[model samples]
Target: MSVPVAMLMAWFCEMLLLNSRSNQSVFRYSASFR
Candidate 1:
């Protein structure tokens, strides 16, 4: 793997991690209101 490719993969993984974390927080917040 090249340097740029490796950086891109790392960035993509970070984005996915951030998105999942946010979604989980949102789900929990909504659940608390019920």
Candidate 2:
């Protein structure tokens, strides 16, 4: 609703998206290694 709140939410969502993407890549890499 407020500008700062919206910006914070957007940043948080981006962080979560990046973390999940990195985790997926790591899982795939480890699976291949096995």
Where model 2 places Cα greater than 4 Å from the true spot, the runs are 22-34
What is the lDDT for 19 in model 1? 78
Mark the 10 consecutive residues where model 2 has the least summed lDDT.
25-34
User: What TM-score do all the candidates reach, one by one?
Assistant: 0.59, 0.59
Residue-level lDDT tens digits of model 2 in 1-34: 6889877766765576577865665555434533
Root mean square deviation (Cα) for candidate 1: 11.6
lDDT score for candidate 2 against the true structure? 0.62
Writing each residue's lDDT as its tens digit, candidate 1 over 1-34 gives 6889877766765576577865666555544534
> How far is 5's C-alpha from truth in model 1 (Å)?
0.2
Q: Which stretches of candidate 1 lie over 4 Å from their true place?
A: 22-34
- Model 1 clashing residue pairs (backbone): none
Task: Estimate candidate 2's RMSD in Å.
Answer: 11.6
